[model samples]
Target: MDRVPILKIGDILLVSIQIDMEDQVALQLQEDLAERIVATGCHGVVIDISALDIVDSFVGRTLATIASISRVLDAETVVVGMRPAVAITLVELGLSLPGIRTALNVELGMELLARARDEGVNEDGDAEDEPGTPAVPAP
Candidate 1:
């Protein structure tokens, strides 16, 4: 029944998975993350899995689900710190983990999120301005 810790840094929510992941734990994380995204109005989520040595199909799906939920809440999700073995296992299992962006580490992940925001892009990668908003012509 161990719960993952979700930390808010600036406008981003950082989730570092330090313990073994079980089905119940993953589900709880998904639920908790959704709530945090709404409550904090954060624009990005970074999941650090560097400590984890393995990832099963259920965990992979849970990651994707978390990303989708974050997008729906107007936030972006980035998964970082995936070990090489974990990546191989995921590929071998045919878990493409769609809708999830990855970085080698948290710093890069935050940079990616900042770049997305600076480009006026939403979680869907669409422009964030409304139709009536004035747009500056490209130079």
Candidate 2:
């Protein structure tokens, strides 16, 4: 199986992946990645997908699972560099990654992670459990 590399950018951990292989191989990589991110104790994470070629249900499931685990580890997982085709395919398949954070590229991913680290989650996050929108401080 191909390895997933983790990069630390301040409180954001950027995980570089190249999983264009079969479902088993890809899921294994994602599982290992989740374990490593949890071990790092980072506050935020970005899963870079610049090298990926396709997206399927199993792949979407793996990513969503990893994101859920990362949130538990106090790290927000941002999926970045997703090709337009892949994005459309996931949407068409009705694969909703509700709790997942996304950005266009590594730079933007880091920026969003910083926001999560600074302002915490958006309205879709723990916000609904409470009441009105919480105030956010400038970054």
Candidate 3:
């Protein structure tokens, strides 16, 4: 029943969870988020799960899968708004997400994303225009 909504802010796609947290929903999360990530071609993904009371293996796996596919889709996925207890439980459960990024909060996560995008641009030294930074570029 709980479905997350994906919002966009400055090349970052922010997804906030609705708390259903069912296995079926978990699978949908991977597919839907992956599609959005590929469609937007954004630099970062912020997933808010503060409302989630529990994160079992299914949800954890779904998140990891989303992160993995997001990378292939050219976007970085960082799970934000995870409570301390939830994080601790996830760690204890032996679900180690290798490539996925985690942030304690949304603001911090966005900062991390900004830094990543900047680093990528600077590395190339192309001085190309940045993506999703307030002004909507012409298509």
Query: Residue 6 deviation, candidate 1, in Å?
Result: 0.5
Please write out the lDDT profile of model 1 over residues 77-137, one tens digit for every residue.
Answer: 9999999999999899898778899999999999999998777545334534556556779
Give the lowest summed-lDDT range of ten residues in model 1.
Answer: 121-130
> How much does candidate 2 score in TM-score?
0.74
- Estimate, for each residue in 3-106, the C-alpha lDDT of model 3 and write its tens digit: 66789897999988867777777777777788787787787999888988888887777788888888788787888898889888988998766677888899
Note the Cα lDDT for every prediction shown. Answer: 0.90, 0.75, 0.81
Per-residue alpha-carbon lDDT of model 2 for 47-132, expressed as tens digits? 88878777777777777888887777767888999998888888898986677778999999888877767676464577767657
Which residue pairs show collisions in model 3? 10-132
Rate residue 135 of model 2 by lDDT: 73
Residue 100 in model 2: shift from native, Å? 1.2
Model 1 stretches astray by more than 4 angstroms? 121-139
Q: Which ten residues in a row have the lowest lDDT in candidate 2?
A: 1-10
Best model number under TM-score: 1
Q: Report the alpha-carbon TM-score of model 3 versus the true structure.
A: 0.78
**Model 2: residues with Cα > 4 Å off, grouped in runs:** 21-31, 121-139
Structure candidate 2, residue pairs in collision: none
